[model samples]
Target chain A: MQLEVKPKGHTVFVYIKGEIDLQETERLRQEVDRYIDHHGMDHLVFDLTQVNFIDSSGVGGIIGRYRKMKDIGGKMSIVGAKPTVEKVLIFSGIQKIIPLYQTEKDRIKAEK
Target chain B: MNVNEKDFRVKNQIRLTIQSRAENVAFVRACTAAFASQMDYTLEEIDEIRLAVSEAVSNSIIHGYKNDPYSQVELYITLWENGGIEIVVEDHGCGIADLKQAMEPTFSTEPGRMGLGFAFMQSFMDQVEVKSRVGQGTTVILKRKVRQPVESKN
Candidate 1:
């Protein structure tokens, strides 16, 4: 998986493309954490439109990052997860914990 | 674990170039679930096997490769002759210093995560084996039996 970070004012947008499974979970977690720590951002959005699949570990990684952002008084949201990847997230109970947006524009609007 | 008269075996292989990270967990989950489905294993058994396989592969990418984007993780799965399964997870990365220490429950190289991958394998699978050497690489072998139990006449 590839994670690209874009700074939008006080929000850090993370655009991830590819499968979020055992192999990419750790790096993704570290990268997200690094961005949050470096920018001290209070809002985060993960773009998963290109993600083909996700698993428990991937779910755990996102949850882990979300908790980190939460503890620091930040908000987190997910945007554009494909059906299969989204199902895994839902199965892992991530949807219950994190809010999902229909589109990137919608996500940006929610951030406002 | 239980044993029954009828048994089946199947082998599946999937290889993809991945920039290793924690997200690989999902791939492992999907693959393992597909494997279990082919074997017709119960949901509980499938879930357990999925978790075990994910933990093993996660160790390979996280500890073995240390999240190197260029490296690849190879997974070979063999469903045995008697409703048993074995998975071989391999990675070309810096090998472990002490096998015993690495398998310890509290010996995680990363923070905020339990050093419990090895321990989880031991608890979840019937057998867990590791082969590694410094500067070479590492391969983790995991096996589990998934059959209905048979009662013997006394």
Candidate 2:
């Protein structure tokens, strides 16, 4: 998996490409957390458009990041989840805690 | 227990044994998804199968083997003639003492781990049965029926 971060004002958009599974979740978690901490971003937008598959481990990793961000009074949202990836998120009930948007522009607009 | 028993008739069966390493989890998922593809399952169904298989194999590696790379986790896939697929992931590592508590959602024994493995398996497959003994091992069996695409009614 590849993680790229784009800073737009106080919100940072993280573009994750490839499958998020047990093999790659830890690296993803570390990279996202490190980027967020270094940039001192107050909000996060996880772009999952290119992610084709996600398992429970991926869900756990996302939730972990959510908690980390929440503890610091920050916000996080997920955008561009494919149907298959969306099913996993919805099934795991992560969508209830974190808002899911169809596109990054929608998520950014909603946050505004 | 006769060799000619009807229950022994499996149209196609494949068994794979791999080390309990994190890298092997993806291999297991890919192999199971490929096997399920033989039934001509839709992409959505195949993704679900892959997710379920990854969860089970991850549990075997993380919880069962405790990240012990030398341990082995076995995966078995069977395709029945009746358009049904069965997958079994087994490990001879540490077994769960309380099966009920283990199956509960969000019940992870370790930090940074979500206890939704069994939940995903149960949600994705038509049937999920887990059998484990404290000292023996754990075996998770998942079954799903594939529907063949119908011809257009032109």
Give all TM-scores, in the order shown: 0.56, 0.92
lDDT of 2 by residue, B34-76 (tens): 7787776788888888988899999998889888999999988
Q: Which pairs of residues collide in candidate 2?
A: none
The per-residue C-alpha lDDT of model 2 at residue B4 equals 47
Best by DockQ: 2
Q: TM-scores for chain B, in order?
A: 0.82, 0.89
Interface RMSD of each: 5.4, 0.9
DockQ of each candidate's interface versus the true one?
Answer: 0.17, 0.88
Highest lDDT: give the candidate number. 2
Candidate 2 local Cα displacement, residue B141, angstroms: 0.8
Q: Model 1 segments beyond 4 Å from truth?
A: A1-112, B1-21, B149-154
True contacts kept of each: 0.29, 0.90
Per-candidate local distance difference test: 0.73, 0.87
Model 2 C-alpha RMSD to native: 4.0
Residue-level lDDT tens digits of model 1 in B80-103? 556667778887888898999998
Candidate 2: residue B53 Cα off by (Å): 0.6
